[model samples]
Target: MSALFPALVAGSDRPALRLGADTLTYEELAEAAGALAVRIGGAGRVAVWATPTARTAVAVVAALLADVPAIPLNPRTGERELAHILGDSAPSVVLAGAEDVLPAGLAELPRIDVETTVTSFGPVPAAFAFAGGSDASESPALIVYTSGTTGPPKGVVLSSRAIAASLDALEEAWAWTADDVLVHALPLFHVHGLVLGVLGPLRRGGSVRHLGAFSTAGVARELGAGGGTMLFGVPTMYHRIADALADDPALVRALAEARLLVSGSAALPVHDHERITAATGRTVIERYGMTETLMNTSVPLGSHPRPGSVGLPLRGVELRLVEEDGTEMRAYDGESVGEIQVRGPNLFSAYLNRPDATAAAFDGDWFRTGDVAVREPDGYVRIVGRKATDLIKSGGYKIGAGEIENALLDHPAVREAAVTGAPDPDLGERIVAWVVPADAEKPPTAEELADHVAGLLAPHKRPRTVHFLRALPRNDMGKLLKKALPEALHG
Candidate 1:
C-alpha cells in the first residue's frame, strides 16, 4: 500500500489507463478506487465481468487498495461458467457497470455503484490508512484461472512480489522505459495481460493505450497514429497483424517505430515468424511461460532473434530441462529433449483448492511446466511438444503433435491446426488433426491433408484423420484447447 500510494500520488498527472471510450489519470483512478474500497467493507473476492475499460481499471485499483482479491472473468463467459466462478469466489460485493453489460445472475448480490460518470456518492472514508505498513511485495494479489488438461478451471495465485519480479525481469530484458507506451489490447483476465500488459508498464511509470479488444485494422491505425512505442500480443494476434500489414507498406513502416514485438501463450511457428519479419522488419520476440509461472524465458532484446526459440532464462530464474524420470540433462547440446522445469521468485504459490494437484506440480521450489523442449548449446530453448497431449505413442513409435501441427500450418490452405491423439485399437492412440482453413468457405478434406503430410511428415507422425472446423477452440489466452477439440469435431 505504501509503495502503491506514492505511485497513485506521483502518477496523478500522468495517463494511467485508457479504455475504449473512457480515460483516467493515476490520481483520479486512485480516488475512484478509494471510494469503491469504502463500499467493499469486508474481506472477500470481487469478480469483474464487464468489458475492459477505464471503469474496470478503476474497479481493480479500488479492489487492490481494499486488499480484496479481484477476479477478472472473461467478459464473454456464459451464465454457467460465470455462476461457477462467482459461487466459488464468493465475492462480498458485486460492483457492475451499465445494465446492458452486467451478467444475468449478478443482480442477486449486494451491489455498489462506482461509476465515474455519476457524482452522487461522496468520497468514502479512507479505511485502514497505511503508513508504511503494507508494501507491494505482499501476498498473492491476483488469482487467474487457466483451463487444466482435465477441462476444469484451476485458479493460479500470483503474488504482488511475483508480479513485481516479473516486471523487473521484463524491464531488464526488454529495456522498457517511461517513454514506451504499450498497446494494451489483450484481455485483463489472463496473466499475460495482467502481468505483462498492465503491471509491467504501470510499475515503470510508463503509459498504456488500452483497446476494448484486439482488431488488426484498429491496432494498425493506432500504430500508424503513433499511439504507443511497443506492441505485445499472442501468436494469433500477430498472425492477423502480419496479414493486415502485408499490403499497407506505410503501416508496416509505422510499426517499425516499436522497439519490440512480443509473442507468447503458444509456440510461434517458424513460418509465422518469417512472415511477421517480412511484413514489419521486426523480429517477434518469442517467450516461454505459463499461468503458474509469470515468465520463465524470453528472446533477447539486445541481440538477433533465433526463430522458434524462447531465449535464455531471465535474471533470478533457474531453468533446467529434465527427462521424464527426473534426471537433469547436462548437454545443453541443443539436441536433447526434456520437460522444462522452472524455479523462480515469480512462480505461483499454488493452484487454488487442489492440494494434491499442487503437490504434484512442484519439485521442491521448481515447478514442473509440462512443456517438452530442448535447450541449445547457446542457452536458447526451443519447445518441441507437450508432454501430456503433444506426444502420441502409436505402434511403439513416439510422435510429436507440434511437429505435425507445424507441418499442417505451413500448408497454404490451413489457417490454424491442432493435432491430438485419438483412441485406436491397434495403436495406443492415433494422431488426429483439426484444422481451420484460411478461407472458411473452402476447407481442405481429410484426404487432401493426408496427401500433404505424407511427403513432409513421417508415416508415424501423419495424422490418421483430419477434421475441419470454422475455428479452433482456444482459451481466453489464445491457446488451442485440445480437450475441447474432440467435442467440437464430433458435434
Candidate 2:
C-alpha cells in the first residue's frame, strides 16, 4: 500500500545503484525515473529492453512510478520468441538504452531511449509522486514471460502488491537492511536477477553493484574486504566460483569476507556447495521460487545452511506439500515427496490472456508450483526435482532425479549429470542417466557409474543406462533443460 521504494521517495543522497562505471545516488535515480514516468504515464503498457544496464533499471523504475505495466524483453531472445512476447503483451512503447540495437519485432513500437529521455527531461512532475494507497497496490506492475517449455511463453502478470510483499518478506528473511550493498552479475530479464537482485536492494534502501558481465575477477574486486557485503548468484555462477577457488585465493578471501552468499534459479549441486564452503568457509544459501510466485522460500539469515535444502517458507507465505491426488501431506519425515503448493500475497495476478492456463495452475487459493520436494520435520524443504521431468518412476519406486544427480556429481569421474525416466517393459520406467564425464578419453563406464549411484543411494535409484555427453543443455539462468536432452539414445 505504501511506496514500493521508500528510500527513493524520501530523497536520500546515498549511492543507490551501480552498473559498471556508472553510479546513481538515490536522489539522481528518483529524479530520473520521475521525469521519465511523466512522459510515459498514460501508456497502457511499456516494454523495457532488459539489458544489464542502468538504463534498463531506470526505465522499469519509471514504469512502476507511472503505474504502467512494464514487460522486460530479454535481449538474447530469438526473433520467434520476441515476436510471441510482443504480440502477447502488445505494449504501446519500447524503452531501451540509447545504443541498443533492437530486433525487427520491436521496430514498429514507439521507442523511448531511456538515457536520452532521462538526460533531456525537465524537473520531475508533481503528478509523478508515489501513490501511497491500497488501491494502487494491486495495479499491474510487470508482465514477465515464462520460459515456454510446454507451449508459447505465457505472460505472468505481477502486481505492485506482489512485488512489495516478496521484497519485504526477503528483507525479513535475509536480515537485509539499508547498510547491505548487494553484488551480482545475473541478467536483468528474470526474477532472480531483476526482481531480487535489483528491486530487492532498491526496496530495502540498499545499494547494488551489477557486474556487467560475471567473472571471478569481477566478483573478487567488488566483494573484496571493503566492498559489497552480499553476493547473489545462480548455481552456474557458484559452480564456476567453486571450480576457481583452488586457483584464486583472492576470490576465496572475498567470499569469506562477504556477509551472505545466496544461490537460486537452479539447484546448486551439493558437491559444489561443499567445495565453496571448504575453500572460503562461507556457505551459499539457496532459495526457491518461480515467475508466477516472486519468492516462496529462502534459507533464513541466522539458520545453519543445509547443503541441499532451500529452507523454510518466507514470511506471509503459506506452503504445503500435496500428493498426486491433491491431498496435502502433513508429515515431514524428509521422505514424503509431493508437489509444492503455496498461497501468498507474493503470487502473480494471472497468466495474461490465458484464463484457462491460469485456472489450471491453481487449486482453491494455492498455486501448484509443479516442483516436487521433501520436507524435514524441522520445516526445511529439500527440492528433489520437477514433478513432470525429474520424478522418475522406476522399479515401483518414485525416485527424485535431483538426489541421484547430486549423488552422481559426488563421483570423481562425473563432471555433469542429469536423470530422466525412459519406458521399460518390466519396470514401467527405467532410470536413465545423461552424464558429462570429467575426462573425455577415459570416461567412466556405465556399469561403474550405475554401481557408484547404487552405493550412494538404493539400487532402484541407480541408472539403468548411462548416456555420455560432452555437455548438458542449460538455459540463460543455468537451469538444465531435461526435455531438451537427446531422445534417440539406445542402450
TM-score of every prediction relative to native? 0.89, 0.97
Tens digits of per-residue lDDT, candidate 2, 215-255, equal 99999999995489999999889989999999999999999
Backbone collisions counted per model: 0, 0
Best by lDDT: 2
Q: How far is candidate 1 from the true structure (C-alpha RMSD, Å)?
A: 3.3
**In model 1, what is the error at residue 268, expressed in angstroms?**
2.3
Per-candidate Cα lDDT values, in order, are 0.74, 0.89
The residue pairs that clash in candidate 2, if any, are: none
Clashes, model 1: 0
Supply the global lDDT for candidate 1.
Answer: 0.74
Cα error, candidate 2, residue 395 (Å): 1.8
The runs of at least 3 residues in candidate 1 whose Cα sits more than 4 Å from the true structure, single-residue gaps closed, are 1-6, 117-136, 148-151, 395-397, 423-428, 439-460
